[model samples]
Structures are given as structure tokens and as C-alpha cells.
Target chain A: MSTHFAADTTVLLGRSMRHVTRSLDTIITTAVMPIAFLLLFVYVFGGAISAGPGRYVDYLLPGILLITVATGVSYTAFRLFLDLQSGIFERFQSMPIARSSVLWAHVLTSVLANAISLVLVLLAALLMGFRSGAGVLAWLAVGGILLVFTLALTWMAVVPGLTAKSVDGASAFSYPLVFLPFVSSAFVPTASMLGPVRAFAEHQPVTSIVDTIRRLFAEQPVGGDIWVALAWCVGALVVAYLLAMATYRRKAA
Target chain B: MTTKPPPAAIHVEGLQKSFQALHVLRGVDLDVPPGSIVALLGSNGAGKTTVIRILSTLLAADGGTATVAGYDVATQPADVRRSISLTGQFAAVDEVLTGRENLVLVARLRHVGSPGTVADDLLRRFSLTEAGGRRVSTWSGGMRRRLDLAMSLIGDPPVVFLDEPTTGLDPQARVEVWAAVQQLASAGTTVLLTTQHLEEAEHLADRIAILHEGRILVDGTLAELKALLPPAQVEYVEKQPTLEDVFLALTQEHA
Candidate 1:
């Protein structure tokens, strides 16, 4: 990439970061539902759900973090949709800046903002007596996994941002994503689920990611789940990036 | 003895665009001389904005070619973009940002030096200095339009396209924007602006092109275009005061 690409992306990313700072409520709102779910499931639904040996909060933190990322990325779609509606995209396109930098700026902003939300959620998890005995490398691995997961979901958000006709439609795409964790081993092991539902829960991407993170957090020997989780995250990110770029080109053209 | 003027800063021939069955521009041709102002006059849905979009490299033409500052828009879009700035029908400023912040953002993106200084200078130029530090959401329509225009000028591009730049502004604000465009032209920038108000075109454009039915019906100096229409017969009547005169007089007095 040329130096201009990096410079232009930084400038545009500054614009998006300014928007995030000005509207603190978006970050707070994104974290609120996931934190509430964390609290509710750990407190109200904890005793009833069979989570084997570990505390339910420990078992559930990985899924709640994933949910936090899922909820946070919808704002990326909403912001992109607003920029499209306001005609700013046209303005930016006409400039001499790198074309791909426009999308990159938003993607980076999503990463930064979601990273903060994840940190906030992690702090709350710790307050609820959730503890991880994993070494430094394991913690780093968990962070890496979360970053990949967020990148995949954020790119997925860009599709509706470019194509949705209305604000509600842009953000509503995240609803199913937030729900996907429930059917997985997030709340309870897939073994306890009925045959058909269990099959789906085991096969979906979320289960692999949650299972991988759960094992790492518990300092267990993470086997093939790590590879499977990486594959899902990387696969989703590549596909979503390509699809989002196609939508952007069609719209901007 | 005067040397021939430089090649046209903007040249287009046989430009065509359509959305499915709705043909917007059909074989439209235009030329804007360097350092001159050309006004595009057309009714709603007359393809004026489409022409601007194509020239600015924001949209591709289905047929024909357009060049801005000697760069073909189809093949050399980056070079074309390097020479042009565009302000759309709506004030495209970011509402969440302060006016100064918006200008700085554009200046920085354009790779200008000392973006803060550029923003400050533009704020003063557009009489937005007082509101420079306030969020654009609190700005009036006129203020937002001025800020939008200011942002477009950050790069000091040689060619500028204003698509109905003063569409929603009040009369006073409209005059202010017109003055800014006039200044831009005087400073050797090629300007192509679209407008619905004949008076606006008359007041600012060195030449006017009337777009109708997906093509330019007539294009020339105001006097030249007037010569094309059938002359009105002479009439003798008592002199009467016009409403425009009365309104201007009243508004001027109030001011």
C-alpha cells in the first residue's frame, strides 16, 4: 500500500473516532444488554443450568463477550448507513483519497470501539467473581480470538450498512447474531440439548469460538477447538470483507 | 493581440446515464473555459446533478467521455479527483462535529499543511468564525451550507462543482454563497454550478446552459441566449413598482 493510503485512512479514522467520543451513549448502550444478560444468566438462571464443574459466570464469560461484540458491531452498520444517507460517502468518494481507505477507517474504528466495550465487559465479569488461572500467553490468545471475532462481525455489519434502505433495517441484522449464542454451548453444554438442536449448536461457528475461549480461560488443554475457532473467524472475515467491498463499489458507482 | 486561452478546464461530449428505464442525461455536451463560471439551469429531475456527479468521478457514464483539468474521468479518476472539489445539493457536513473540526477533517484528508490554520481561515472567509467551535447539529441551514462549501475548498482544487449550493438558504445567505463562488472564479478557479433560480445564474455565471429534456437546449452568454428567443413587442404603460423591488427595499431597511 502507498503512504497516501495510510495517511488517508488515519484522517478518516480520526473523523469516525471523533463521532464515537462525542456519542458515549452508543458504547454504553452496546455494553448494557450484554452485561444485563451476563448478570441475569449468572444470578437468576445460574443454579438451574447445568454447567458441570466451573461457576456459571466463568462458563458464560466467553459467550457474553461474543455477544458484546455482536451487539457493538450493529452500530458500525448504523453509522455507515447514516453516512450513506447523508451523502457524505459521495463527498468522500470524489476526493483523491484511497478508495478502500474509507471502509478501512470505519472497520478500524469498530475494532477500537468494540475493544473498549469488551474490556468494560471483562471488568464486569471479574467483579462477578469470574477468575482465569491461564498464563499470560493464554490471555493473549483469548484477546486475539476476540479481536478476530470482532473483525468478522464488524465486516458482516458493513453489508447492511451499505444496502439497508432504513436505519432500523441496518441495525436489525445483528439480532439473529446475538441470539446465535443461546443455542450454542454458551448457556449449557450441547450434549444436554435434543438431537436436532444439538447438531446445529455443535456445527455453528459460535460454539467453536465459545468452546475454544472457555477452555483457554480455564487453563485446559485446548485441542482442535482452537483450530476450528480460528478457521471460522478467519473464514467469516474473508467472505464478509469481499462481500462488503462489492456492495460498496456497487453503491458508490 | 491576445494569446488563445488555455484548453477548457472541463470538457464533455455525448454523456449519457440512465436508471433502468429512466434516462437522466442523453448526449449532453458541455465545455467550461478555464477560470470562468458556467451555470447549469434546469428544472427538478433535469439531470443537472448527474452531470456534476459524472464530472467529479462519483458516478460512471454509460456513454461518452468527460475530462476535468485534462484528465479523463473514466480512465484517470484519481487524477481527475485531484483537480476537482464537489459540494452536493445537501449540506454534507458531519453533524456530530464542530464546524472547525469538520473543516480540519477535510483539510487533513486533502493532505493540506496546518489543517487548523486552513480551517480557521475558511471559517473567517465564510463568516462562520463565531460558530466554528460549536457542533454542526446546532447550526442553521445557512451555516451548514457555508461549512460544506468551506470543506470543499480545503484542497484549493482548480475545478469546483457546486450542485445547487444555495438551494435551501435564505435570500441573504444565497447572496453570500454567490459572492463566495464569484470570488472563487476571480481567483482563477473553474466553476460549474447548477441552479434553479434564473437570477442566481444571471448574477454569477459568465455563461449559462439551460438543460431540458435530457439535453442542453441552449448554452451561451445571457445576452446570447436572450437573442435566441423571439423578441417581445414594445409596450407603453405607466411605470409600476415590482414586489421584488418592494421586498428588497423593506428587507434592506430592516437590516
Candidate 2:
């Protein structure tokens, strides 16, 4: 790609970022739900739910963070739907900028906004006696994993954003993503579950991701789970990015 | 130091498009001379916007070829896009941003020198100086349309396509937009506008092309088009003012 593509994406990213900053309530709103879940689970059910050997807050924080990313990506889809409906996409498409830059701007903005929400959730967890023994390298690895995961889901959000017939349909895809954590080892141990349920929880991407992150935070030896998490993230990112671009090209054409 | 002038600003031959069973444009032909305004007159669903979208490189034609500012639109979209700007039917400005911010964003994307200054200059030119700092959500429909046109002109492209620009504006706002368009044409920018208003075509277009059933029924000057129609039947009656005349007179008086 040419330098103009970068310049154009930066300019458009600035536009989307402004939308986020202008409505600070959107970021707060995304963080609020995950923080509430953190509070509800830790204070209400923390004593009852025995997740592994460590504190439940530490174990639950990874899942909450993932939910935060999921919730944050929904707004990306909603905003993209609004842009498509507003005819601004057509205006941008007719310009000389790189076509893919438009989608990239939305995806990058989603990453930035989700990262901020994740940090906010982390700070809240710390206030609630959630301690992490992980070092800077481990923290960086966790951040890398979350970033990749957020990128994958944000691209998945792009599909509904481009093709949804209504405003609600654009955002409805996130409901399943947010609920996926509940069925995994997010709030409870998969080993405690029944046969088929445990099998499904162990096989899904979120369980692997949450397990890897929980291990990273507890300073445990993260064996093949890290590889599985990385593979899931990278695989999802590749597939979602390809599908999103194909959908984008079809819509733009 | 003399060079031959460039060819037509826009040229098309047998341009066609279809959406499955629906054929939108069927072997359309057009030629827009440099620095001239050609109004594509058509009713709703007459494929006027489709033709404009294709010429602006926003959509690909299923068949035939089109060129804008001497570059083939199909093979050289970047060149075509670089030379042309479009203001879509809906005033497609970022409603979350202030007028100045919106203009600056487009100017920066177009790589115009000193984007802030260009934005300020455009705001002044478009009579949006007072509203420059206000978000577009608060602006009147007319103000938004002006800002949309200002954004399109940020690149200083030689060719411009305005797809039913005044579609949803009030009469007063429509006149204001027409004045701005006339100013652009006077400054030597080629403009191809699609409009359903016959008077708008008569007032702004150097040539009017009547689009019917996805094809041009007639393309020529207003007088030439008038010649194509059967002569008006003469009637001996007292002269009477038209309702349009009364409306214009009343609005002018109020102004």
C-alpha cells in the first residue's frame, strides 16, 4: 500500500475516535456492564464459586475482560451501520483514498476503545482485591492476546454492520459473543459441569483464551494453553478479516 | 508556449449496468464539455444516480466504457477519482463534527496544503463561518448541504457530480445551493448534476440530457430540445400569471 493509504486511514481513524471521545458515555457504558458483572460475581457469588485454587476475582477477571471487548465491539458495528445508512460510506468510497482504509479505521478505533475499556475493568478489579503476580512480560503477553482477540471479533462485527437490515440486527451479533463466556469456564470450572457441556466448554475459543490469561495472571506455567489461545486468536483473525473484506467488496461494488 | 486543450471532461459510450433481473442503465451515451454544466434530467428510478455513481467510479458498469478528465474510469479509477468530486443526494457530512472539523477532515484526506486554512477559507466561502465551530447535528438542512459541497470542493477537482443536491431542501435553500453551484461553474469547474426539477435544469445547465428508461432520449441545449418537441398550439386569451410566477414574486418580495 502507498503512504496515502496510511494517511487516509489515520484521518478517518481520527474521525471515528472523535465520535468515541465526544460520547464518553459509550466507553463508560461498555465498561459499566463488565464492571457490574465483576462486582456481582465477586461480592455475591465469589465465596460459593470455587474456580481453581486462586482467588475467584483473579480467575473471573479474564472472562470479564473478554466480555468487555465483546461489548465494545458491538458499538463498532452500530457505528458502522450508521455510517452505511448515512451515505457517508458512499462519499468516502468515491474519494481517492484507499478503499480498505475505511474499514481499517473502524477496526482500529474498536481496538483502541476496547483497550481502554479493558484497562478500566482491570483497575476496578485491582480495587476489589484482585491481585496479579504476573510481570511486565506476562502483562504484555496478555495485552497482545486481548488485542488479537479484539481484532478478530471486531472484524466479525463488520459483517453484520455491512449486511444487517436493521439497526438492532447490526448489534445483535454481540449478544451471543457476550453469552459465550457464560457457557465456558468463565464464571465456573468446566470440570464441575456435565459431560457434553464440559466438552463444549473445553473446545471453544473463549475457554482456551480465558484459561491462558488466568494462568498468565497467576504466574503459573502456561503450557500448551498459550499456544491454543494464540492459534485460536490468529485463526479467527485471519478468517474474520477475509470474510469482512469480501463482504465489504461486495457491498461497495 | 501553447498546448492543445484537453478533450471532453467526461465521455461515455454504451455504458450499461444490471442488478440480476433489473437492468438499470442500458447502453447510455454522454459527453460533457470542459467547464460546462450538463443536467441529467430524469424521474425517480430513471438511473440518473446510477450513471453519476458509475462516472464517479463509485460503481462499476457491467458493460461499455467511461472516461473522466481523460482517464478511463474502469482501468484508471485512481486517476478519475483524483480529478473528480461528488456530493451525494443526502448531505453526507459527519453530523458529530463541527463544520470546520468536517471540512478539515476532508481537506487533510485530500492532502490539501494547510488543511486548517483551507477549511476556514471554505467555511467563509460557503457562508458557514458562523456555524463553523458548531456540530453539524445542530445545523439547518441548508447549512449541511453547503458544508457537503464545501467538502467536495476541498480537493479542487476539475470535475464534480452532484446527485440531486437540492432534493430535500426548502425552496429558499434550493436557490442558495443553486447560487453556489453557479459560482463553481463560473470558476471553470465542470459540473454534471442530476435533477428532477425542470426549472433547475433550465436555469443551471448549459445542456440538458433527458434520461428515460435507462437511456438518453435527447441530449442538447434547451433551445435544441425545445425544437425537438411539437410546436405549442396558439390560443387567443388574456395573459395570466402562472402560480410559479406568483410564488416567486411573493418570495422575492418577502426577501
Candidate 3:
């Protein structure tokens, strides 16, 4: 059964990867907004805001990557919604192969496609003079965290993809996810704020995640921030996966 | 000496399903013998899709039992799925993939050893070989529907369920699908097709089952069904040309 699952998922992944490769615009469009944010933050706001030393682009790259993922996951919802609308979902469910492979395929595709978008955003940051002195291991660690973060958020995207009544509704869940970075340490340090907003910002998942990634890039000791970051990603992944699967069972039933 | 009867290719007895308060299938019983076609005729909201969904293992019935190829759908869904292919109400082909790729995708999923060859053969048989390389998004409605049917034929499952296969198609396209279905009959595939079109049932099914208000009101061959109604009146009257006839004549003249 496990072997059948791997084969089914590989085949379905190839199918959606063809979709991803053909529709180059979904990736480009996803990358564009975060790239614009990177530019606006680095050039326009970098002069006024003091980010405590190095290039603002360097300080800002981690947050922009999060925004990139938040934006890219909407395409996952959009693609899944199209599958439901086309009746292909039912066709697949009625087939003899592993049924769970259908959703697993989409989740895997979201991770891969969002990884490409992250790379594009990273390239844009490099063009803006962002640099990292972190070692190869640190870079791999960054990749690992981002991969889990993407997986966690992709499952969240699946819920709306299954339940939303309209295309706009399906993709609408990402707006808040994209906005989450601004309130966190992504743009301005949470230490600067002094109120309920600061309290909320400091405690949120995005803050710890961004802090951990930023610290890694700066070659600073990650301390306990890395653990908190992994906890957030894994926690969100568990809850979202359960919610999405339950919803899928009802919808398929 | 006593002999056991052969199991049906598809069977359902007292199958019941509901969505909260809306009762869909209420004790619907049906059977399709091996190598025959059964047309499930019903009006809108008559639960035709519900029956097909249950039989194809896409949905669990609320009560009773269904079996496809001697495997119970509710108890042994995997076996039932292996024995049946479903062509849904819409064209389920992936719009981004080429027609041949769509066929190959299903063939591979069904574990066919040489998916490429299977796709190519089906493409030829459906007369889609010329356009098989182009993405399905660019294909006409008829072409897409034909490809949809062709995809369902892969792995050659014993039973096939088609739900409103020609619902939105033009007359020519409908005829094209009918021909494909006729080919399935000649190849001895057991088919249970649903449609609101009585003409379609008259043309394709050996047995027609009329479903109304969540139950089968009548089930029999065309002649038996016709007998249930009053005998046809024999009369002679002057013929009048239909608008279809006029349109065809004018178009032919212009050609």
C-alpha cells in the first residue's frame, strides 16, 4: 500500500508539475508582489528606518521570503478549486489507486512551486545588494525551516481550497497571511513598539520564525528561537492537516 | 442438478442516501448484467447522479448494498473501484495537459504497463490523434468530451458509469458519443449510463429504468416500456417542415 501511494503521488505530481511549468505566470505573479515589497522597503523606507547595522535588504530578506510563501500558497487553493470545478476530483477518487495521493500530490506541488518562488525572491534580494555571511550549514538550515513553513501553510491553503464557494474566496485566505509579517519583527523590530500591539507582535508565530531566520543569516546564535519557529510550523501543519483531511472526507463523501 | 446464477456486472438493492433533510436515493434497486447497457432515465433532481456515485464508490450509501463486478462498493471499495470507470457529468480532462497526456495519466494510474501505447491507441480510436498533442483547453467541447470518454476506457474495466455524457453537446457531438458507446457495447463492456434525454435511452440502452422522485418507477426493455403507455394512433396527415428541416435546406442550398 505504501508503495502504491508513492507511485500514485509521483504520477499525480508530474501531472501538476506540468501545470506549474506551463503556467509560468502563477509563479511570476506570486514573486512580483514580494519583490515589490523588497524594493519598497529597501530603497524607500531603508533610509528612514534604522535596522541596526548591515544592509536593510539583508535584514529584510527573511520577512520577504515569508511573504512570498504566503502569496504563493494562494495558487495552491486556486489550482485545487479548479480541479473540483472540473469534476476531475471525482474521477480520481473513483479510480483504483491510493485516494489520499490526490491531495498529497497537490501539497507536494505547492511546496516545490513555492520553493521556486522563494528562489526568485532571493535572487531579487541579491540584486538589491542583500548578502549573508552564514555558512553552508546555516543556509541549509534556512532552507529546511522554509520548507516546513511552506508545508504547514500549504495544508492551511487546502482547507479553503476544499471549502470555498468561489475562486476569490478560495484565494482570499492568504491576504491575512501576507499581512502577518508587517506586524511582526519583519519590518520594524518588535522592541520598538510599546503597547498591546507590541505584545501581540512579539508573541505571534511569524515574529519568532522571522527572528530565527534573520539570526541564522546574520550568523548570530539562534538560541531558543529556532525551536519556537519549528514548533509554530509543525503545530500549524498538524492542525491544518487534520482540518483539511476532515473537510476532504466530507466533501468526497 | 442445481447451478448458481452468475453475479451481475453492477447491482444495487435498497440503496438509500440523504444530505441532512434532503433525501436523494430512497431504496433504489437496479442491476446490469454482464456485457449489456442500462440507461437510467430521470428528470432533474431525480437522484440519478446519487446512484451513479454510490455504484462507482465515490460516495458511501446511507443504507443497503451495491456491488460492481461481484465486489461490494461499501465493504470493498478498492475492488469495486478496480472494476469500474466513471465518466462524470463534466469533462474531467485536465485542461493544461494534451489529450494524449490525459489518457496516459489515467492509464498509468490504473497500472497499465505501457501507458504511452495505451494513450496513443485510444487517441486513434477516438479520432483525436490529429489534435492529441495540443492542450485540451484549446479543444472544442465535442473533442474534449470524446477524450473524456476515451480516458475512461483505459484499463478496460468491466463496468463503466457515464452521468449525462452528452448533456451539453450539440446533435453531431451527441451522435459522436453515441457511436463511441455503441462501440463499447460491441466490445462487450457493461455500461450503466444516465441521462435526462429519453431519445438517448431509446437509441442506446437494451434496458431503460425510469427513476422519479428517488425511486425506480419502471424498469424494462423499450418494447415493454412502450406497452405500458397507450398504443400509438395510426393516422394520415399532411407533413409540415420543421424549423430544423428548413434550416438544413437553406444551409445546403447556400453551400
Candidate 4:
């Protein structure tokens, strides 16, 4: 049974990957927003913002990567909504395929596609004078962190995908996701903000995550932020995964 | 020792299902013998699709016992799924994939070996070889529906459920689909189909079950169903209005 599920997931994953490949726009769309932000921030506001010594692009790149993940997850919801509205989910359910394979295939595809978008935005950041001194192990750690984060967000997207009344409703949930990083340490440090807003920003999940990535890129010591970031990502993943599967069971029920 | 063949390819006893407070299937029962073409006739929202969904394992039944290919739907869902195929009310083919690719994908999902050959065979059988390479999004509704039905046959399961298969089809496409369904039944594939078109049921089904309000109002051959009502004239013209229009007129006057 596990073999059957693995095979079915592989086939469906290939189908989803093909869809992603054909519409280069999905990847292009995900990368474009963060690339635009990187270009605008580094060229227009880089000199003005006091992000300590080094380059402003370096500080900004980490946050841009987070934003890239936020924007990319919207496509996951959009694609899932389309598949639902198109009645493809019903078709898959009837076949002798594994039930969880359908969801896993989409989740896996989201991870792969978002990874590409992250890479694209990073390349554009390099062009804008962003540099990272993190070695192979640090890079691997960053990849793991981003994968967990993307998986968490993608599963959250699945809930809306299954339950939303309209296509706009499905993708609309991601707007707050994309907007979240700005309030964190993405652009300016939370320490610079006033009382309550600064407190809220310092406590949020994105700040720790962004701060950790920023420090890692600059070869600075990242102490507690890394642990907090992983905890947040894993916590979100667990909650969202449970919620998504519950929604799926209700839908299929 | 050889025993008499089993009751039917599909057997349902006291099958009951509900959604929240609304009971969708109220103790419905059915026994569809092997190789027989059974048509389930009902109005919209009458639980015909719901029944089909349950049989195909897409939805669970609140209460009842249903055995497809001798596998219980609730207890042995995977086995039941392995023995059946379903073509839903809408064409469920992936528009992003080409016609041939869609068939190949389903074949692979069903664990068919050399899926390429199975796909090619189905494409040729459906007379879609010429259009095989083009995306399904470019195909006409009739073509898409045909491809959807063809995909359902990839695994060659014993029983197939077609829920309102001709709902949005043109006359020509409807006839084509009917022919394909007829071919499937003739090849000894037990078929359970739901349709609003009485003429379709009359022409296709060896046995018919009329469901109203989620209960089996009547079940028999077409002649037996017609026997339940008074013999009435069916007006026909060279180019006539739809049966739905006439049905609405007659039933509406009675109401």
C-alpha cells in the first residue's frame, strides 16, 4: 500500500511539475515581486536606511527571501483552487490511488517551485550587490528552514483551497502573509520602531526568522533566533498540516 | 464444489447517507447482477450523484452495507476502489495535460504496465489519436467528456459508475458516449449510471431504478417502470422540443 501511494504521488507530482513548468509565469510571478522589492530597496532606499556596516542589500536579501516564500505560496492556493473547481479532485478520488498522495503531490510541488523562486530572487539580489558568507552547512540549514517554512505556508494554503467560496478568496489569504515581513525586521529593525509596534514586531515569528537569516548571511553569530525560527516553522507546519488534513477529511467525507 | 454465482456485481442493503441534518440516501437498496446495465433515474438533488459518489468511495455512507465486487464499501474501501471506476457529472479530465498524457497519467495511477501502450490503445479506441497531442483545454466539451470516459476505462475495473454522463453534451456527442457505454456493457462491464433523460435510460438500461427523495420509488425493467404509470401518448415531431419542457408542462399542470 505504501508502494502504491509512493508511485501515485510520483505520477501526480510529475503532472503538477509539468503544469508549473509550462506556465513559467507561476515561477516568474512569484520571483517578480521580491525581485522588484530587492531592486527598489537597494537602488532607491539602500543608502538612506542605516542597517549597520556592510551593504543594505545583504540585510534586505534575507527578508526578501521570506517575502518570496509568502508570495510563492499564493500560487499553491491558486493552483489547488483551480484543481478543485475543475473537478479533478473528484476524479482522482475515484481511482485506485492513495488518498493522501494527491495532497502530498501538491505539497511537494509547492516546495520545489518555491525553492526555484527563492533561487531566482537570490540571483537578482546578487545583481543588486547582495553577498552571503555562509558556508555549505549554513546554506543547507537555510534551505531546510525555507523548506519547512514553505511547507507550513503551503499547508495553510490548502485549507483555504478546500473551503473558499471563490478563487479570489483562496489567494486573498496570502496578502497578509506577504505583508507580514515588512512589519518584522525585513526592512528596518524593530528596535527602531516605537513602543507597542516595536514590541509586537520583536515578538512575531517573522522577525526572529528574518533576523536569523540576516545574521547568517553576514556571518554574524545567530544565537536564539535560529531556534525560535525553527520552532515557529515547525509549530506552524504541525498546526496547518492538522487543519488541512481535517478539512480534506471533511470535504471527502 | 461449484456454487451458484454470487447475487450481483454490486449489492447494497439498507444503504443510508445524510449530510448534516438532511438525509440524502434513506435506506436505499440495490442488487445489480454481473454484466447488467442498470440505470438510476432521478431529478436534480435527488441523491443519484450521492449514491454514485458513495459507490465510488468518494463519499461515505452514514449507514448501510454495500459490496462492490464483494468488497464492503465502508470496511474495505481500497478493495472496492480497486474494482470500480467513476465518471462524474462533469468532465474531470486535466485541461493542462494533452489527451494522451491524461490517459497515461490515469493508467500509471492505476498501476498499468507500459502505460504508454494502454494510453495509445484507449486513444485509438476513442478515435482521439489525431488530437492526442493537443492539450485537453483546446478540445470541445464533447471531446473532453469522451476523454474523461476513456480515462475511466484505463484500469478496466469490473464496475463503472457514470453520473449524468450526458448532462451537457450535444446530441451527436451524447450518442457517441451512449455508444461507448453500450460497448462497455456489452463487453461484460457492470455499469450503474444515473440520468435525467428517461429516453436514455429506456434505451440503455436492462434494469432501471427510479429514486425520488432518496428512496427507491420504483425498480425494474423500463417496461415495468412505465407500467407503474398510465399509458400516455409521447408526442414527437421531426424537430421537437425537449422532453424536459413537456415534462415540466405536464407535471406543472398537475401541481
TM-score, chain A, candidate 2: 0.98
Poorest lDDT segment (10 consecutive residues) of candidate 1 chain B = B240-249
Clashing pairs in 1: none
Displacement of residue B43 (Cα, Å) in model 3 is 0.6
Tens digits of per-residue lDDT for model 4, B1-255: 898766799998888998889988999999899999999999888999989888888888888889999999888888988899998888998999999999999999999899999999999999899999999989998999899999989888999999999999876688789999999999999999999999899989999999998788888997787788888888876987798567666766895
- Whole-model lDDT values for every prediction: 0.93, 0.93, 0.93, 0.90
What tens digits encode model 1's per-residue C-alpha lDDT throughout A137-178?
999999999999999999999999999999999999999999
Give the Cα error of residue B219 in candidate 2, in Å. Answer: 0.5
Give the TM-score (vs. native) of candidate 3: 0.97
User: Top TM-score: which candidate number?
Assistant: 1
Off by over 4 Å in 4: B1-6, B229-255
lDDT of candidate 2 over A28-147, digit per residue (tens): 999999999999999999888987687789889999999999999999999999998888998898888888999999999999999899889999999999998799999999999999
State each model's TM-score restricted to chain B: 0.94, 0.93, 0.93, 0.88
Off by over 4 Å in 3: B1-6, B238-255
Winner on DockQ between 2 and 4 is: 2
Leading candidate by DockQ: 3
Interface DockQ per candidate: 0.84, 0.81, 0.90, 0.79
TM-score for each model: 0.97, 0.96, 0.97, 0.94
Question: Where's the lowest-lDDT run of ten residues in candidate 4 chain B?
Answer: B243-252
- Predicted model 2 interface RMSD: 0.8
